[model samples]
Target: MTSEAAQYWENRYRERGRTWSGRVNAALEREVNGVAPGSALDLGCGEGGDALWLAHNGWSVTAVDIAPSAIAIGAAAQQPGDDIEWVVADLAEWQPPRRYDLVTASFLHSYVELPREEILRRAATAVASDGLLLIVGHAGVPHWAAHTPHEGEVVELPSPDEMLEALRLEPAEWTVLTKALVERPVTAPDGSAGTIDDSVLMLRRNPAVS
Candidate 1:
């Protein structure tokens, strides 16, 4: 069943060419840039845009997604000198082979009722001491509200505080550097444009010894 969803995403990417606009997620690029180079894992890395960016920026990345087609596309698109390992696996079942300096999950908004705490726990566990875990996703309803009218299927979002509490990080372990609801314009599949309000949260892991 989960494999089917991955295939669906792969097909979607194939049909859409590239769903992402070839730009790294704004919050991650800004907050995670200064961290020292180390192993990085990109969960739900669609089309490898962000993974490619990280590889170019000095991080050796293991980019994972549920879709094999997406992984293939990303592998083919990878440029010379950009080092990235693409894996096809569901995040719930996938485990990192080693700890990392940075762990990121961006725009992963599916499974609203899913146990995000467990996911965050795994992410936190995968991080080395002094490492960073960066989770960025759409804060509120998705931009394509008209297309997805179903209640639980679409627009299911989590508050920043909810995520922070779920992760169980003490105030001393991490700090919320940015948390805000931001409105941004979005273009629809029909070429129509609209606005979406997204909640953004950026957390920085404290390097100080616990």
Candidate 2:
């Protein structure tokens, strides 16, 4: 665990009641709904929105985050007998206990220094054979974010191709399902609104791989 990064997220959630919308991410819902329910791993699951949704959809889910407070909040909202496990751990060092049919990392970016690619590669490894790995990242900072303190700063996030390259999966061993930039309207932290680009990358590990 990166102690500094963990502390930063904890403080951010503490100062702000919630850092993100409690609802599941749009891309996650769209991608997951078409598939059959199975074991899932939600990496960097802030407040367990995706995990809760998956559990409700009949998926046995394991959700992890760096902030214990966030996990506590999510745990409190879990319904009785829901097959969701909320875990507080730093993704920088933590490893998934078992492979899963679906592994998702939605907007897992952080201002704190961490090896993003390395963590994502670990996520890919946690996907079971013939399973799916979905990674969603901000293609660029939203125009509304320009009004914030980061004004005039160019925030460059990884492109879908760049992320695919970082994963270094063999073409014969994995199938690239989707790689595109999706635009969506959003309300920023200060209530400013604008369209944001999301870099979506979804891959499936071939069951034939030894």
Candidate 3:
């Protein structure tokens, strides 16, 4: 599915003038604000919105995404002093060469077959000791979508608890910081107001005991 997935997003980005809002995701900004800034990894970073925001907030960031065009859009937006390194690779197979202080996956949902659970488990391994793993996912169909991202596909949205189970986190080594369903407001293409439900899971990897 790698080629198919890459092509799907590449076409989507090329077809649209700007596929995503350049602004940082609201949930990410709200959740991590005022925390000590450090190295951050943004998985499936579409156009580097969150990575840019992290850079602005004094974090060295590594942002990865599958589509070259999508990341090219992000690379074009970089400024003179942004401490961000962008990578083009499928998250399903990409491995973090080093650990980070904060690893985030915002709206990592895809229209293609992605081993999301396995990918996320590997993502956790990229978190440094005492670092954070923040995942934000669509909890249900968007209020404005005529169909899901995969048109007419009956994808099941997992509950927060269900997702936690899938991550297969070792409780002795991880602490669940936040688990909740959050509502995000949105504007439909027709300028109508709507809301989307999102699942938020924030985990902190415990420091090694002496």
Which prediction has the highest lDDT against the true structure? 3
* TM per prediction: 0.82, 0.91, 0.94
CA lDDT scores, all candidates in order: 0.75, 0.87, 0.89
Per-residue accuracy of model 1 over 70-144 as CA lDDT, tens digit each: 787788878898879999887767888898888888877563334455776788777766777777767655456
Where model 2 places Cα greater than 4 Å from the true spot, the runs are 147-156, 188-193
RMSD per prediction, one decimal? 2.9, 2.6, 1.8
Q: Model 2 — TM-score against the truth? A: 0.91
lDDT of 3 by residue, 1-210 (tens): 558778888888888857888999988998899899999999999988999999989999999999888899888998889999999998878999999999999888766777889998999999999999999888977566775245644455776787889998889999998889999898888898989888888899999999
For every model shown, the clashing-pair count is 1, 0, 0
Best model per TM-score: 3
- The global Cα lDDT (0 to 1) of model 1 is 0.75
Candidate 1: clashing pairs of residues: 139-199
**Predicted candidate 2 versus true structure: per-residue lDDT over 31-141, tens digit per residue:** 778799899999999999999999989999999999988887788779987899888889988989999999999987876777789999999999999899999999887
